[model samples]
Target: MIGIDLGTTYSAVGVVESGFPILLANEEGRRVIPSAVWFGDGAVEVGEKALRRRGVSPVVTSVKRLMGRRPGEVDDFPLPLDEGDRVRVLGRTPEEVSAEILKELKRIAEWRLETEVRKAVITVPAYFNDAQRSATKRAGELAGLEVARIVNEPTAAALAYGLDKLGEKARVAVYDLGGGTFDLSVLEMRDGVFQVLATRGDTRLGGDDLDAALAGWCAEKAGAGAVDGRMIKEAERVKRALSADGEAVFRVPFVDGGESIEVAATRRDFEHLAAPFIERTIDCCRRAMHDAELSPADLDAVVLVGGSTRIPAVREAVSAFFDREPDLSQHPDEAIALGAAIQAGVLTGAVRKVVLLDVTPLSLGIETFGGLMNVLIPRNTTIPAKAGEMFTNAVAGQRSMSLRVLQGEREMARDNWRLGEFEVAFEPAEKGRARVGVQFRIDENGILEVLARDTATNRDTVLEIRDAAVDVDDEKVETMVSESVEHAFDDMAERVFTEARLKAEELLPAVEAVLSQGDGIVPEEEVAGIREAEATVREALDSGDANRLKAAVESLDKATEAVAARMVERAMEEALERRMGG
Candidate 1:
């Protein structure tokens, strides 16, 4: 058995060798495979070869985002869906395209091991609905591998982290921002057991969105024409470069048939462009921490997973949110696959003494009176578990009742996703009738099953739902924290600017007064540095960027410290002179 990280942008296969998990390199000696498939000349190509044929052949990438997605729910679907809830990728189903990528990964593993690999564990985003998970499992089956388990990406990363730290008891928050999805999971490691306390995420959020945002922003700022696939690829390259350098140039040739567009953006500009996506992930982290009932101080470490976390801005954002630097102990791209390999090792007797547990991503419930959501299984509940609630007929002499099953983080049923509804036969009785018990059972794969039982006559009505309205509850996540405090972000930005401006207004005058008193106390080179800092502060003030202004003002304060000490000395000398004269 091997372990696979079927990612949105890249995929990898790993296995346990000598009780140590390692990712398998393919014939090309590449450990990571780009999650792209190209259909051209009646043949299929996968990975880097396919990614290179972006404009030539019909290439499909980020197909993971299209799984179980409606035509409108997602901003950009790699393919169009057929009538039967299937996507047609240039006559091939989305699953088939995904299967091709998985098949390549399997072949890589088989070649590395020099043996047949069948059974495997795969990882998915913690927020993936049952529908999406099922699609992934089906893809695995199509790839000639038996699906042994479906582990959440964050949980898998945590498993990798705890593989070497089994004896340490600590709480960890895994911040996973992959290519097409993002999830944050809070977990605890105790005596070799890894327990996920809570999980929160937005499936529609990830590095792809950041790339698109960067591409569009650069084109508009460069005064160039509309963006295209070429520009998007360039933006991705620039983004990767910005992860290491302070600034990078985005260049797209022949953007409008003749004119080439060139845009240079500092890391700060890119961070501003990427701020909204980061803020959304931070919102998810806040919810996950709240659900886990833990604060930043309570977490011993915050583990970063997925390729996007390599960006310096992303690391800084996570550090700010967690109040501590992220633990870069695991490879951002390979940790999930390696963790899955560890789990596979545990199951196959290669590894020993470890237990793993995961939690549901959202609250599950049914609609009650007045369109309210009555939560039966709250978000963060331990999975492979069951919860039940009792209800009665609302009207007198009712023969049956209709209930809408919902999943979300909202209090209103209408605001949540209606997973599906079912009709249960109710015994005729007066209002507030006999106890009808409703139970929700969720398995380790996050698939849900609902059962309604009549206590009076012991009759059971079962309803099984497989399809989700959308792959992610992005609408609800958008409102999770923003709606709670309307205009708070905008107001906070204004407040930040005002505060920074006030500091500059006060600090500049104080420095000038000291400079006017005398120049001997402050060195000429130091005086020149203070003037340069003041000019930089003024430039930042004119820019109207709160963060930049704040940074500049702080720098100026540090530069003028010598002058500030001179003011104190002069004041003391004047006091002594006045006393002597008196």
Candidate 2:
């Protein structure tokens, strides 16, 4: 059995070895894979190697956003390809692209374990809606793995933690903020069963926003001429560095008017730029707690995941809000992936004692008169939830009527996004006399299915919400399995080379940038204080101490809270201004 954490920024695979869940290293003997892919020359390359050529490789980093898009949804960019390329997306879909990445992860897992693995469990956000869940299932098929269950990320984290908790039941809050998404979940564990009380999150919000905000601040403070895409990317790395160090400084050399100016960024300044983003997460935490009908005081423990959780201020704010310090024993990046492997073990009957019962994130409803929305199933309802609503003909002798279904919280139909629509034709009848019953059901994975029947005609109509096919056929899965055995190459060597290159590209300048900004952001007396922290991080980054790098990142985050807070205020102001103007 194998488990996969298909995260927005990175992916990882793991399995139980010698009675302990150990993350299986990639072809490079490293555990994590960058959740990025490069498109070139009619081929798709994933993970670290794909991330290396981000700009040059026509990479797609946030395909998760497009998972359940409706017809005519605009793509961020034309996929990296020339006209007449053999891989035509118009004939394909986002699921296919995502599946390609999953295939790569599976290949790495099978290669490292030296085993034939045909089944696994995958983890996703607890708040993911039906369309998103269905899309994931399809991706699993495309990768040639039978997806036994789509476990929620937070629930999985709790399971991984609760496995050691034994028979005691505890109310736990899982705070997970990954590269591209954030989720807060409240769960209850009793007798080995993990039941989710509530889950809430902003699917579009995450650590990436903090990096962008901090980078923009760095540009403004140093007057770095103009901010470019690469500068923004650099700001992200710098912000990541600030999470572990108390104060940092570096010079960002760039061109302006035939001259070069070295722009500097400090950990303090970065935090000032990012404080508001952290606050946003706090707001989400509050909401999730409310939805669960519990207060922070009710939580037994707050478990953190995602790279962003390493920030000191994030920990402090969470601690302050909940009136207790968070438990930081788990590896933020590896916990979810490890939990996924455990779930996989459960699915394969290697571990048979656990079951996960999760819930949907939003209400499912239909549009009614005056653009009002009538919800059939409210958000946070346990899955596999089911509800039925009756329909009638509005006009005499009307034979058919259209049903528009939406998924969201708004009262107005226009405000809520339409998941899909179906038309039910009824037998000819007196106007307003025909009775039709429509049943909406959400499965464990959160995928929606609708069935309608005309009572007068005794005819049944069913609609399966349609999406692009990433689901593979039997023949394709067989072929992929064969390719796995026949194609032999050095996967680890390739992964290591890619990770080392990316690390080198991201870190060296990161340390120096922190040093350069020290003079401007801290007092003269504090210079040595900042330098000492910087020195420790420099040694760790140089020595390749993952823990040290991780610590340095958090220390920097604490020193820079004021800056991140200011950025948060600015973001909130801009949002308010936009709403006011509208």
Winner by lDDT:
1
Q: Model 1 reaches what TM-score against the true structure?
A: 0.78
User: Per-residue lDDT tens digits of candidate 2, residues 481-551?
Assistant: 22423432333233333344344444445545744664344446655655565566566557655455666
On the 0 to 100 scale, the lDDT of residue 28 in model 2 is: 83
The superposed Cα distance between candidate 1 and the true structure at residue 117, in angstroms, equals 2.7
For candidate 2, which ten residues in a row score worst on lDDT? 469-478
- RMSD in order of candidates: 22.6, 26.9
Q: Provide the clash count, candidate 2.
A: 37
List the candidate 1 regions with Cα displacement exceeding 4 Å.
78-87, 426-435, 454-460, 469-475, 478-582
- Against the true structure, candidate 2 has what lDDT? 0.71
Q: Name the top TM-score candidate.
A: 1
lDDT tens digits by residue: candidate 1, 1-582: 999999999999999999999999987889999999988777888999998998665678888887655544554654444554545657766578889998999988888888999899999999888778877888899999898888999999999999988999999999999999999999999989999998888888999898989999998998876667787788889999999999899988776678788888889998998998999899889988887898999999999999999988889999998889899999999999999999899889898989888888777899875566788998778888799999988667888778889877565566567888888886799967766899999887787889998888889988767545444445455465344246556545655776788789878887787777675777888988988999999999999998889999999999987777877888899999999999
